[model samples]
Target: MGDLEIVKRAIAGDDESFLLVMQVNKEGLYRTAFAFLRNEHDALEAMQEVIYRAYKNMHKVKEPSYVKTWLTRIMMNYCQDQLKKKKRFTINETLNEISIDDGTVQLELQEALKKLSEQEQQLVYMKYFQDTKIKDIAVMENIPEGTVKSRLHKILKTLRQHLTEKGEMDHV
Candidate 1:
């Protein structure tokens, strides 16, 4: 079913519909939250809270079509609150953990991804990691499609430069 139909049923207290909502968007939502929180543990906690909040306050959502944005906004707020509490560094620990199976070049790309600005990182994560369309990202970021395109271009260029400068371009 569509998100709107799912939301309508969820609002009407159909628990299965609510679970369906979770099943459909959980991975995307978790990845988006992870972009902001950076730690899997913290991101999971925030996602759980977001789900609880969304469930409890479903009536407050004004439009059926906006459920995705609404849930994201809730997750964003929860992430911000968690950030304030943590006062974490720019270099999140999650980014530091390297996998041995990935090659050196892949590792370099991972490190380069870690170097991106928070917004740039989010854009890359939303676009590549979560496979979100640029239009949807523009809507979610409250920016124009042109801006999203421009940012992606600039971020990709910068990431390549950073990786090359760091001698990790061979990985790519």
Candidate 2:
């Protein structure tokens, strides 16, 4: 069966379909959580919370075709809330424990991304890290496709300027 049929069943409160949908999307969801939370424990926590949230909100889904995007948005929102809660307690310490898998260039790019506003960061993460289509992002954000493209252009310009100023890049 196609994603649409599975998503419909899931939304219709079929337990098996819900579990199957979660199973198929788990890896991508975890990766997104890890990218935001920056640790294995927190990512797993975020994943569990997302599963609960997805189950609770399954009926709210408007488009079965966008189930993955909808789940990703939930994960992102949960991770962002968790980050906010953490910031309230801890002094904003720099995260130095870069994953061994991440390259130096990736680290530099991450630093640049940190300079962006939360909305901009989400836009970048969805478009680049998750490889979400521009139309999908537009749908998720309730913006026009042209606006998504324009914002991305501006975000890339800002990132290029930041890297250039830091001597991480010789040219934009």
Candidate 3:
């Protein structure tokens, strides 16, 4: 069945349908969670939490077609919450371990991303990392399509400026 039909059945209290939904979206959900959490263990935990929350609030989903977006938003929220809690404890273990040894450009890009607001960061993640469409992002963020496009444009401008200022983009 399609995602919409599966979502409808899941919302109607079909446990198997719910599991199927989770099974189908698990990879995408984990990738999104890992993008935010930057750890396998934390990503797994966030996925579990998102599944629990989505199952509990399945009826709140207004459009079955956007179930993937809804689930992703939930995962993002949970990962953000975990980050906030980690901030309170001043945990350095996870943060220090999530280093990119591939290239300095990636490190510089991450630094630039950190300078963005949470919403901007999310937009970047959804657009680039998850390869989500602008319309889908708009629906997930509860904003208009034009608004999302404008915001994304501004965010890209800001990132480019930040990287240029830091002389990180000179090589490109």
**Could you say which candidate leads in TM-score?**
2
Best by lDDT: 2
TM-score of 1: 0.68
lDDT of 1 by residue, 11-90 (tens): 77789998888787787789778767766888888888989998898877666666776676677667767765665654
User: Per TM-score, what order, best first?
Assistant: 2, 3, 1
Over 4 Å off, model 3: 91-95, 168-172
Model 3, residue 71: C-alpha shift (Å): 0.5
Model 1: pairs clashing at backbone N, Cα or C within 3 Å: 105-171
lDDT of 2 by residue, 23-121 (tens): 999999999998988889999999999999999999999889899989988998898888888889877553665665787677778889878988898
Relative to the true structure, candidate 2 has a C-alpha RMSD (angstroms) of 2.7
The all-Cα superposition gives candidate 3 an RMSD in Å to the true structure of 2.6
Q: What's the lDDT of the predicted structure labeled candidate 3? A: 0.84
Worst 10 residues of 1 by lDDT: 90-99
Provide the lowest-lDDT 10-residue window in model 3.
Answer: 93-102
Which RMSD values do the candidates have, in order? Answer: 4.4, 2.7, 2.6
